[model samples]
Target chain A: MTGVTARRRGRPPRAESGDTRDRILTAAREEFSERGYEKTSVRGIAKAAGVDSALVHHYFGTKEQVFEAAVEVAFAPALDAPDAVADGPLDEVGERLARFVLGVWENPTTRKPLLAIVRSAVNNETAAAVFRGLVVSQLLRRVAARLDLPDAELRVELAAAQLVGCAMLRYVIRVEPLASADLEAIIARVAPVVQGHLTGP
Target chain B: MTGVTARRRGRPPRAESGDTRDRILTAAREEFSERGYEKTSVRGIAKAAGVDSALVHHYFGTKEQVFEAAVEVAFAPALDAPDAVADGPLDEVGERLARFVLGVWENPTTRKPLLAIVRSAVNNETAAAVFRGLVVSQLLRRVAARLDLPDAELRVELAAAQLVGCAMLRYVIRVEPLASADLEAIIARVAPVVQGHLTGP
Candidate 1:
């Protein structure tokens, strides 16, 4: 009902602002990517978005908040992927988790946000905190809840170590062979390893 | 060996400069750690070392060369571990590799340079490239040579991904449980995963 009513309005106020907010965030992502966390600023992001400086602050509050919001938007889709991954067969959870996460890296859209996080997170404490919280509390916790094991969190983290490391080399560091290897080949070789971390003896 | 003559020198010109070079490199590593790659400058590094900028340039040509030299020294001890690691029992290679690599991170001395690289590599292309060269060409290649498999190089990288990721989480990001878990506990849980990546079908 809310959706229908909102759609019916001529130049809906909320939707219009929502569009503005999205525009600012998109600009913020680009700014951070090009200049990094420390060098990027609200005024610059606002200028890039073609919005008033006050309005940028009004929408995002602060630069840190802007970073938080931008990553949240970028990571939104990937966060939902593992939301459903837990209900499947226990035996194949590793492949499912590995593929889904790596699949996010494989896809350009999801890859950009994660790449931003991975890129910025290394140099800045704020970025690293945000990345850790998102991967652990939001992403891994959802997966861990399904395992119903005592050491599920540790297991999940170790599994994450493997996946994150591979992605770092292949995508971030852009190392040879693995960086260019077929996605399926990596999935085949890496899936079982991820599985071992998730459910090994 | 030449070691005796070097030790016997009364202010040997070579050893005196070697000490100075070590001091400058130490200052450079500290600067990189604190300010990151982009914000760091050769002038600032020289200032920290209490040396003339000309001497800094004399010893290490540019900022990039300084970074390469700093990480090379920081990683010097670690670079040697895998050199001998390849000669060990193949089946136990995973445990030995994991223990040694993670051990490097575990030791405060070796960990500092690695921490600098991991922290800086995310945002800087040069740092990432240098780290990739060191870890791949210098470190993983040695271990891969011993595997004698067509896919050995890829396999070794995968194993590195796992260890590197775990170290990132544990040491850099400082994620809980895994970060604070007893070192032995991490090795016990993570070694098999590394083994799987190394030799699994």
Candidate 2:
């Protein structure tokens, strides 16, 4: 199903170019989630998507490109999260940030891919570097700039560490007490520490 | 070798039972560090140690047991770290904990196996559960007990989250600036957040 049949016959296809690309990305996500970044292959993704390997390469130039695209698609919902915290008063920023992140993970649709990314990123070097770059530049630094506090960068990173650590424990590792604890309770307990990092004396 | 040459056919060996176990553990550490928990096998460890696979099975009941033993051996240096914080004044506990944990990671010798464990734990469910159990019950809970504060368990866990998150970024993920930052400076920036978790209003 390399589209060889469609191309040779010169027939109008049911799926357009955009649909094929989407299918490749969806397949890539599934592959990455199941096997992780290191073990995932372009050929595997292409086969899963019912396309030729060349087509996958055509849509995404490289494996890294496809992974980057996958990460972009997976994390799209939280791209605005830093701004969400930025618009709020300084004191309440921590709670808002916590809620936004936990809410993203708590959602059924979003959590699947994100869980894969977080789990895979930790084990794979390339994935970790990509994830680190996005988190630091896109999410953490942006919030740090808005705070205008001394050690602003460090402060925001520490806040991120808290929340990210919480996510790792609760969602990925499934650490108990924290994992099974009520969402609001965790927010109440964790927010103050984050706030301290952001604006404390 | 199966210790056949080292052991006598009719007499007791002089090296003692503990020496054999220690040798097995050392080999296990090397294998686990290089290949991680999932890929490392008892046979591989036995081959590396120049012992028969039966010897490994004899010394450690199973792969999980060997891994647990390896973790214990690897983390032995920092096993007392929580108590080190527990012995100090409440206000300074955060600094002590941060300094101790970071110091362990910053050292070349300790960081290797810990890195393997952290990286492997994220991608593998069994490893994650084992790691979660050890960190929570053995490390974090001991410190939480010393706090004697309300929600002390949750509080200590949150503190653990922040430090664990920082470790994930600085060591495993290699997030820049934070990764390259001076050790004491990070301690200065992170200690307060931990303090808040441990002693916040």
Candidate 3:
């Protein structure tokens, strides 16, 4: 029976290591970054990863799921931010949040996917819905829960707007001067304002 | 010959009465508000306006152009803002600017398109690019030119970020409390911050 099964198989089973998954993710990130989510397809990702299309589907059920995974991977640094904020002095929360968020944008490895999501969210409803869901559910909800204030939800949402808007101008739009300014300079100047929005009376 | 042609046309062959153009603009505004820029197509706008699809093409060659027209129509109030700022005392410029901007967002007629653009800009590259061009060239440049400060450009951009961020939270995301709060109260609270950004030391 084993011999018959081996004969029936077209080729030896490929290595089942997680390397293929990582490669697929990396390829997906690149493809999504270069071409927004709508333009990117599973076949494109598979071709980029040098893997079978079926393998891509086997690993990730749908393109949206793959896109979500890519976003999560890109936002991995941001995902760790809650722990970092928890570790730091409560007073320094605003500064830490600013630094962490800015750091993600400053890092090339993450910026591509971040930019892709931002660019896609502008024109694509599905992408916007997904992005909005991630922001509201994952990021804003946690930040809001951590805050000890009246209207905490509103405050957190506003704080997020401040940070996201700064990011939109500085990184996504690449507006002059703000775009070229030193990172620390920006962090120092903007953190207090964000802090004011977050915890201020 | 002109009279004969006019008679042959049945109606007086009115000089492209802006009624159709106005209807398309209105429909486009609603479509964009409800469906956003990417999902709302020319055909959809035409259908909504009860006009032939070809009329949409004849009126506006492309979706981008239509979007531009829609923005211009929607933001007619904002386009007057620079002149308003330029006409007023420089000292009150910040407060006036804030009032004008918040007022626009507070008005339902204007707020919808503004919200649509903000939401769309997040995901669409072309839309983002167009938004950046309009903001930088039309709005920020004008404001910067009016400022007597040393780093007028940076100041204008920063002030813009503050205002845009506030609007992003208050409207598009519908952050509670602030979203439902009095506009004058917000203007009073944040105008100074904007003032500081624009003219403060």
Give the best candidate by lDDT. 1
Please give, for residues B1-201, the per-residue lDDT of candidate 1 as tens digits. 689788686676888899999999999999988878878999999999999999999999989899999999987767778767777789988999899889998898877777778767877789888888887888789888988899998999889898988988888887877889889999998888778778877
What TM-score does the A-chain of candidate 1 achieve? 0.92
In model 1, the Cα lDDT at residue B113 comes to 78
Q: List, residue by residue over A126-197, the lDDT tens digit for candidate 2.
A: 888778777788888877888897678878877888888888888887777778889999898888778878
lDDT of 3 by residue, A1-201 (tens): 999888766444464446788899999989987777777899999999999999999998799888888888778767867667535566777788788778888998878888887666654567666777776667666776777676777666656666777787888767888889888877876677667767787
True contacts kept of each: 0.71, 0.66, 0.41
Better of 2 and 3 by DockQ: 2
Highest DockQ against the true fold, candidate:
1
Better of 1 and 2 by lDDT: 1
Reference-based lDDT, residue B119, model 3: 56
Error of 1 at B69 (Å): 1.1
Q: What is the DockQ of each candidate?
A: 0.65, 0.59, 0.31
Query: How would you encode candidate 1's per-residue C-alpha lDDT over A1-201 as one tens digit per residue?
Result: 888887677676888999999999999999888777878889999999999989999998988889999999987776677766776898999889888888888998877777677767777789888877777888788778888889898888898888888998899888888899999998888888878878878
Q: lDDT scores for all predictions?
A: 0.86, 0.82, 0.77
Q: After superposition, how far is residue A98 of candidate 2 from its true place, in Å?
A: 1.8
After superposition, which runs of candidate 2 have C-alpha atoms over 4 Å from their true positions?
A1-15, B1-20
Q: Tell me the interface RMSD of every candidate, in Å.
A: 1.4, 1.4, 3.0
